[model samples]
Target: MNDAAMPKGPATALEHFDVLIVGAGISGIGGAYHLKQQCPGKSFVVLETLESFGGTWLTHTYPGIRSDSDLYTFGYRFKPWVGPPIATADEILKYMGEVIEENDLSPHIRYRHRITNATWSSRDNLWTVEAERLDTGQAVAFTCNFLWMCQGYYRHSEGYTPEWPGMADFKGRIVHPQTWPDDLDLKDKKVVVIGSGATAATLVPAIADDCGHVTLLQRSPTYFIPGRNANELADILRELKIDEAWIHEIVRRKILHDQDLFTRRSFEEPEAVKQELLAGVSAFVGPEITEKHFTPSYRPWRQRIAFVPDGDIFQCVNRGKASVVTDEIERFTEQGILLKSGQELEADIVITATGFNLNVLGDISFAVDGKPLNFADTVTYRGMMFTGVPNLVWVFGYFRASWTLRADLVADFVCRLLTHMDEKGARKVTVELRPEDKDMPLSAWIDPENFNPGYLMRGMHLLPKRGDKPEWQHSQDYWREKEELPLIDLDDSAFVYAGTKARTPEPVG
Candidate 1:
């Protein structure tokens, strides 16, 4: 392979790389690092649509934007997170930036390159990716042996907001957190925020002091884990002056172990786990408020349980700066909203912190062997590679645990698969259902009963199907995946390797 032969920029010629990673977010950054460190022999490039790195952190500009999951696990396994357990978006971006600077990943990443189409050719064992440079509006192309999709599974252009009657009649501004405006002022204005998800929880407290009155209006209550942001294990390790890397590994393991136990108890001892979670919130807002606004009908862990970090949200509620209203919205009123209970609430600004719309595969049109790819028609292989999709892996993270946890696992899997392909003199590899799995029952990507969020429920039809087997389903259990992903049998019959193309020798300077 010669550097002189690579495509320089926007041109009719396609740049050649051993691997092309989509998105430069946390997953994408980690993927790039893994490819560089584990498979140094492979040439790779990361294409991000945004002007800079940090996919979600860069796109989301809403106040109080922070991670619900702890940074110990949310941060990359190779990186040492020195911040508090819960981190703000700025802190996260700084951390991700350090990863890039430390690893010299900036040169390998091309910003403003929005991939529009990815076509796989079986004969050539290559993927031709088409992209448009958002800055210049010029189209670019790249050819790669493998496509790594780290683009997240959500619509970044806008957040999902349910249409309410008479929204146009309202005299105030209505905004979704995903697309929060900078010039908008909330000072001395009565605000109403809709939805009970993490976004709502994060926003209410963030703007409570500035707003005249902020109310969290939810149709139903959701579970929350209100606690201190500090991790006791990390605190002790720091006191002992232990190495930062050692502390990170120790705290990460402790958190994952506790999370697994808590998740298992949510199903095994639903009543007990529910009471424990309620007690945590009750400690801050009291039993009445906890039962009325924090108690959820479903068991704990059904949906994500956000960590409140020093009970910040509850503190605002306790001090009378913010309030919670549990009722369905009948329609929008001239001033605010009309509830089903015949109550009218007044508001000057409405923030719909309602979830995001799922965008599968970065909303890129994909094709295999010249046929359009209908993801719903295919079944996921361990929630990464799909049936009949060759030389590609989609990094879909976990639901219960931190997302980067699985990202690291998938990185290792991809690196291993690439190395194995090189050793076998193969250029393409696709996962197919084994003969024994041909008749297995198939269902939605994720079971509603296990973990059903509004966004997932609304976009389940757009996702791929999943089989009953462990290898076929995502099995969002990070604790198990951390142990299993490393030991996966790459030689299993489920993996079909093809094409006898040998690796090209590197060119001398």
Candidate 2:
């Protein structure tokens, strides 16, 4: 009970930090800069609900976004993207504002605040939180001893708007490549775009040169793949001087061991070499749009194939300036879009690129002494702590390689579990994974039907399994997570720690 005895409306209280970090994104500023570089006199903050700080590159602003991995494996292995190879979102928000002003981390960041709730007191082990502040809507509170979330999912930071049916009587201008409006101007008009994944193959070759006819639509079928990503091998490893943090940890462990050996040989031999990589993507989308819609019924790495670079959405749908339409929208009219075989289509602008809106981690709420937290009855402990949740930690990444290489191996396993709880004084730690550690059968590419969230398939049954090296495995490979989480050793016994009392300082007002 601090933050000056929490009360008054949009609350405000403080003090008691040894880490709080909810979502200053990029996995809570890379787990608060590796827990302030391994507990450098610990006391952290980071809240951030956006007052600006590139979480999803400053909340994604549609139109040709970019970075489908490859800025030296989507940056951050102690910061290393000297630029280019798919970046732009204002150059990854100016490289996250130069990694928060070269780690001065904007005075431990607070921004627009917005946490919403957190609990776990257990006779003052700490973790009170609360937050609100979407600009003076007030409400705040704090008390830490480690929490960390790193909010990833999505909860309408504006995007994912589906429903469709007559969509407020169409009349054009629908958009939603995560809220892409930016003064809506589709030159010759006609647009459309619906969804085939990866934001409808990167918004149909980036709004087909200012649209005049686009279409896309698709309700199923997605395995596009063509992405080239060339910053000319990071400018020939910065003119062979290399060491941009060892070439972003060896090109993010060689693109996470070549996307886990091409998704484990395209799912353990999909009739020999994933049917020749789906017949070389149906001879590069030819045979009448690969039998009318790049053939798919779920197979090639189940779902996740929307790279498109050199093939640029199959050369903007074979030069007709885009037009895919596999069909299924079924409703929405005021000026077009009504397919399910009825075929209406028209549109002057529609876009959906229908996806996102999962909200497992970002919906944040948690509780413990006050009970709450039914994060579907907790389970994930190694996929970043949970089992009974004690000094919390969330992070979450890898929908199959390159989400900042499993968020830089969960920020080097949370700075090697906060330097093995500061050399055993141990104030708190959790680390789980041992219900007989799920008796084998884990990596069907981090299964749980490849994430539709059941708290991310019960947090991939507390991760770290895919062995055969890669240092006791969870290795989405990246050079075995740079030799098992940044050159190993931080003590282990698979984490657990406890002890308390030593985290007091608060008052920041």
Candidate with best lDDT: 1
In candidate 2, list every pair of residues with a backbone clash.
Answer: 3-13, 3-14, 10-138, 10-139, 11-139, 11-140, 15-506, 166-332, 253-478, 253-479
For residues 1-509, write the lDDT of model 1, one tens digit per residue. Answer: 33334344645566789999999999999999999999999999999998899999999999899999999999999999999999999999999999999999999999988888999988888898999876666778888999999999998988999999999999999999999998989999999999998889999999999999999999999888888899988999999999999999999999988999999988899999999989989999899988889889998888999998889989999999999999999999888999999988899999998899999999999999999999999999999999999999999999899999999999999999999999998899999999999999999999999999999999999998999989999987888888898999999999999999724324334
Question: lDDT (0-100) at residue 482 of candidate 2?
Answer: 51
lDDT of 2 by residue, 1-509 (tens): 43434444745556567778888767777677777776678778888888777777777778778777666666677787777666768887788778888878889988887777788876667788887776666677888887877878666566556575778888878877776767899889998887777777887888798888898887776666674556455568779898788777776666666767777787677567555655666666766667668777756755556556676888877788988878787789999888889979898888776776557666667788888876544445435565567887677676655666677677767766766677788777655544445453434225444334233343443233342222223333344455555655545544567775645545664
Q: Whose TM-score is greatest here?
A: 1
- On a 0 to 100 scale, what is the lDDT of residue 33 in model 2? 75
Cα RMSDs, all models: 4.2, 20.1
Each model's lDDT: 0.92, 0.69
